[model samples]
Target: MNKSPGFILTQLGLDKDKVEKLVKALDPKTLQIAITDDFGSSFVLSTLSANIASIVETNVVLQHEKDGDLGNGWLETNYAGSRAFVLRSWKPNESDVLEANLTFWRGAPSIKRVVIRHVPEPATQRLLLEKGDVDMARNLSADQIAGLAGNKDTVVESSPKAEVYYDGLNQKHERLRNPKVRQALRWLVDYQGTTESFLEGRFKVHQAFWPSGFAGSSTETPFRLDVAKAKALLAEASYPNGFEVSLDASNFYPSIDVAQSVQATMAQSGIEVNIVPGEQKQVITKYRVRNHPMVFLYRSADYLDPHSNADTFTRNPDNSDKAKSRPLAWRNGREIPQFTEKTDAAARERDPAKRLQMYLELQKIVQENSPFVIVFQVQDQPARRANVKGFVTGPFADQIFYLLVQKRGSRDRGLAQPGSPILAGPDPGIRAVACDAPRASDPRHPRAHFLRAARGRLRDRPGGTDRPRPRDRG
Candidate 1:
């Protein structure tokens, strides 16, 4: 699980009565108030410090909602907001609908709206980007990005991601319990060769779990494939003839290929590896439960900080209350008090220099003793149409900064026509051309119902029934 510090929720013009009504209907534990203002104007919602680590886990925020069931009735799909965009209703396993707010809290979003289609296959995603059906192709392979080089309308953006792909061992297994045996297996992996061949020179051989430029990263190249060294270590650990172990991986492209490559390499050292492939969700479940003896997976840090990586990978709840679990690299329930102490101190440290030292020390310690075979750091390639401005790929695969994106000619062409592009040219006295007026029931104005409902709730003043006129948002 990756953890971060940036997600926020605020009241968006909902009346006191509606807020209270929604709060009463929802579970108390969904969001606890750490502190309410003395003026009764605002409150800080807390994630109950204990389970803070789990916040980074996938879908933790949306896990409570059931099929076609949003938790609160009064809390309808549309909540009035001044954010760049408000989320409209969505179909499960389909698409996310967002509509722009001209009077956004920060400023009006450049583009009127965005609809993200769910495209799982890379081939189809690439085709969409090439054919101009989609504006961007995320997580595209190097080859795919290269294929779009000749397309004048498209451009590929490449960045070094704070991620690593590795094979983790469940230390609870008797054969892998010994540090020597685990170290031996690490040597059996051809990390450098895989980066050069499979990754096509795009990725770098990362020795430690942390990304190269981070505070807790190392410049050491300790483990390399040496058949003699692997054999010696295996024999020393009482497995001279090698032992067979099942290597499980998600049926994804590079992951399966990596597992197969490792199988061939480890075979030379007498470590018979049976490659087992399954769906990503099922494979992760097996890894999380410590059922898989070995797992080949790709995991990225949730945040830019070293604490995010260290807290999730090194510290366990038993030793450090801050962490709940470290399922990716199972440690056989081994509690290292010293490791926990250092990690906790680093997390609380305010001095940047001292904090850096603490994190670097932890990385070195974990690298020497942990049950992980660190492979390589990820290099991401995301392609977008040249007209799709203000979008960049962050370390996280799913990070979307759509509000910042604007089509190059959006200003002159005004609002875009859904089924077509906004056209612009070198014509004299060019002026913004507004599209056909939208209908009241258009999805873009999802909160139209809420606005109407609020209007109907007129209250009786001393003289007469008083109602509020809609504010001129423009």
Candidate 2:
């Protein structure tokens, strides 16, 4: 039973001798991980700790109760995964940016001194990038992207994301427990109208939890606003007069707007929705641990695989007390034993073709019964200063390949000639690249030179050749 020394050492605060002895004495059941989506790729899924997994899988409340204050917090970094950057300090900075200083190790990029300034507000981020303060602005709204068009000093790049924003109904609630009532609610939502009008064509309507283009994605809008059908289902569920329920959501822009839209549309079918607004964290706490009657939240895959999502919504335990993760359907006491069996079997399947079929089958089964009102898949939009060369972002927010980004002439090329593209490249045009390895560096001479290069030359000089960066690099 090989265990991760890094994880164990940090968690227990024990000496090597004591830790090894404790690990050897533990029972096998106490060290088992419920889900292991370790399919070989750049991405893989597995619990950081076997001991913690055994507890949290059975009691979801334990995770939420701690929420990072306790040692068992889900996101508490045990140790650095890669030695490319040793996180020295992280704290809230001016203008709402979360500043994190990363000390360089060997095999790191040439521009080694790195400080990740995380700016959450898109508008503030855009202003900073344009004024030559910050070099990059991420997840720009469609409006911001439109505003940057034809600007010689900046470039807008985008990629399809694996994230989904959906509405979850708690089956534990009397009115929501009935399958027909659940189905009735799905039909009452105007998924198409919300995505098209409110989202401004930035999102794609999804039929299930999985996003489109994935192996199991249905990409089918099975439910639509049909007042008559919704009414009939409510009648069947003994809710002819419809019922009143509270929906909790964050003040975040599109989410609050979506909840309000659902509130208005559901009223047509006699379902009265009371929209409760709160901060994002407060809303999340209410929905996940308290099991709010209705919740509008977003979920994104940790890895680019169908099992990453399917297994979570399906493998719910019959005894809710033993449920490892809170499945949307289980919140309302809805049961589909077959759904659990099928999804678990599929997750364990080795053959690619067979796995794909299993995921598709799972989607169909969930859509026909579950308490999930699947909404839309979002797209990522990031804008960078034209001078910032080689920056790339992937489908997920954390999929940043910052090591490849190099400033022009950081190593060899001289100041680009007048009118030449200032790194808005179809290519960042360089002859040879450095090795991709991280080694220990002298702390005193930490390459602080990179920061100066990052803010240089916003526009092309005379005789400059402009080449736009490829959209597919990330």
| lDDT digits (tens) for residues 1-474 of candidate 1 | 111232212112223334444334235235333223221111121112111121111122234345634322212332322345555544333555555655444676777556666565667777877766667766566566667778898887767777877778776688987888888887888887887675753577876767886555776768888888989999999999999999999886678888888999999989999989998888888776667888888767755667656765676646332345553433334466667767767766756677767778877876777877778888766677778878654555434456688776432111111110001111100111112222335555535643444455643222211222323111
- What are the Cα lDDT values of the candidates? 0.60, 0.58
List residue ranges in candidate 1 displaced over 4 A: 1-80, 201-203, 213-215, 219-221, 317-332, 410-474
- The number of residue pairs in model 1 that clash at the backbone is 1
> Candidate 1 lDDT (Cα, whole model)?
0.60
**Which residue pairs in candidate 1 collide?**
82-105
Candidate 1 minimal-lDDT segment of 10 residues: 420-429
Per-candidate TM-score against the hidden true structure: 0.68, 0.67
lDDT of 1 at 356: 68
lDDT of 2 by residue, 298-325 (tens): 8776456676677566666563646755
